[model samples]
Target: MNIRPMEYVNRERINRSKQLIFLEPEQKIQDISMRSGFEHPSYFCTVFKRLEGMTPEQFKKSHGFGI
Candidate 1:
């Protein structure tokens, strides 16, 4: 399957963010977004929602993180 480079990168970022959410429950969403290589937290949330069907914060809550 062919994927756009941006799409692949966003997917990877989202995956990394997911791991961070699970492993670093105390980390802030902004920090996680930066650690995941997103320059801006707003864009990170946008891409995350597009790929995961939820914002990072929502994902964290749904996954029982930062509760």
Candidate 2:
């Protein structure tokens, strides 16, 4: 089953989370989840990976701390 409204919200939320991931690499994924409108951290991880093409940790490690 597909949900149009939910999909739209999901996309918007994913974009915001991507920004958070870039702007706050020091923050843990759970923090990002809470800040980005997600109540569940594990669910955030799953959805984030699906949309962003990589896990949050991998994104941070790839571009964080000057490397």
TM-score for each candidate, following the candidate numbering: 0.92, 0.79
Candidate 2, residues 1-67: lDDT per residue as tens digits? 4768877787788888879878877777899888889999998888878887887777777776332
**Candidate that would win on lDDT:** 1
Model 1, 1-67: lDDT tens digits are 4999988888998899999899998999999999999999999999999988988888988988764
TM-score of candidate 2 against the unseen true structure: 0.79
Q: How many Å off is the CA of 9 in candidate 1?
A: 1.0
RMSD of each: 1.1, 3.1
User: Residue 50 in model 1: shift from native, Å?
Assistant: 0.4
Task: Give me the runs in candidate 2 sitting further than 4 Å from their true place.
Answer: 1-3, 65-67
